[model samples]
Target: MKITLIIPTYNAGSLWPNVLDAIKQQTIYPDKLIVIDSGSKDETVPLASDLKNISIFNIDSKDFNHGGTRNLAVAKTLDADVIIFLTQDAILADSDAIKNLVYYFSDPLIAAVCGRQLPHKDAN
Candidate 1:
């Protein structure tokens, strides 16, 4: 199945670089990576812009609605069979992360699958 990844970001700073690194380690690469950035004053846009398979769109920070922005990203990826959402701070524990998550969709009834979220090492 063709899958697309959508990540919503603001001034994500150094967190997003680690997230992208983890993505690169995934056994299965997403067919497309759509980054919806909300007017970050930092380097967030430039950092994700050059990545392979990445498509970026910008919106005013005030215009960024978690639900609405995600809906817009979904609309842009009509070609994908499944959509995966991730936060900029999320990092995969292993290369099998995406592979394992996508496996659940083998059942036609399963419309979506969410990966496990472990607390960050620095999280209190």
Candidate 2:
């Protein structure tokens, strides 16, 4: 199955690199990664650009809309069997995270899957 992963990013802050690194280490890497960046003044665009099989689309920060960006990604990955949307700050817990998630699709009746999130150790 063809899998596409999309992320909407702005500045993404200090944890952005870690998030991208985790994605790179995934056991089941996405066939295509679409990064929609809203005019960031920081290193977001440059860092994402260096990755292979990634398509970066730039937009003015003021024009960003949560639903619209995802719709655009859906259109761009029309041929993909699965499309995964992820926040720029989300880091996968393990290399098999995507593999485990995609495994559910073996059951043809499964329409969607949601990943569980855990609080950071520093969170109150």
Candidate 3:
């Protein structure tokens, strides 16, 4: 099954690298990776520039509508069997994170699946 990952980011300077590393280690990497950035004035764009299967789209920071931005990414990867929504701050719990989420879809009854998110240690 094909899976696409969509991330909405803003000023994700320090955090985006970790997010990219985690994506690289996923048990099953997404067939497509789309990052809709609201004009981050940092290295967020450059850091993601050379990654495989990744496409970065830019928009005015003020134009970001949480739902609309994600919808735009979804519309771009229509052939994907699943579209994963994530924020820049989210780090996968383990390599199986994406693998497990997609595994659930093997059951035809499950139309879509969302994974659990735990607070970052810094949030403590």
Candidate 4:
């Protein structure tokens, strides 16, 4: 099954690296990694360009709203079977996280599933 992971970012330099690294570490990488930036005034775009296997989109609007940016990103990937939305600050642990999420979709009745976020030991 094809899955698209959408990560909406805005001046997310402080956390974007961790999120990208986490995605790279995933055992079951997303078919497509969409990084939607809302005119970030940092090196976020450059950093995203350095990553392999990622699709980056820059929203050039002067006005920025989180939901609007996400909606735009979602519109860009309407063909995907599943859309996994993650924030720029989110760090995915366990390489199999994506795999696990996809596994749950095996049940026809399950529309969506979300996992809990626990503080990383290093974050303490």
Query: What is the total number of backbone clashes in candidate 1?
Result: 0
Q: Can you give the lDDT of residue 85 in candidate 3?
A: 91
Q: What TM-score would candidate 3 get against the native? A: 0.95
lDDT values for all models: 0.89, 0.88, 0.88, 0.81
Give one clash count per candidate, in the order shown: 0, 0, 0, 1
Best by lDDT: 1
RMSD (Cα, Å) for all candidates, in order, is: 1.1, 1.4, 1.1, 2.2
Error of 2 at 36 (Å): 0.3
Every model's TM-score? 0.95, 0.94, 0.95, 0.86
Native-to-model Cα distance after best TM-score fit, residue 19 in candidate 3, in Å: 0.9
Model 4 clash pairs are 27-95
Q: What lDDT tens digits, residue by residue, belong to model 3 across residues 7-122? A: 99888867679888888889899999999999988988888876789989998988899999889878889999988998998989898899989998989999978798899877
Give the per-residue lDDT of model 4 (tens digit) for 13-91. 6767887788888887778878888788997878877666678988775755778888888898888888899877778
- Report the C-alpha lDDT of model 1 over 10-121, residue by residue, as the tens digit: 9987777888888888899999999999989998889898778999999998999989999999999999987889988888889998889889999999987778899887
Runs in model 1 with CA error above 4 Å? none
For model 2, the run of ten residues with the poorest summed lDDT: 115-124
Alpha carbon lDDT of residue 26, candidate 1? 88
Model 2 lDDT tens row, 44-104: 8888887768999888888899999889778888999888888888888899989988999
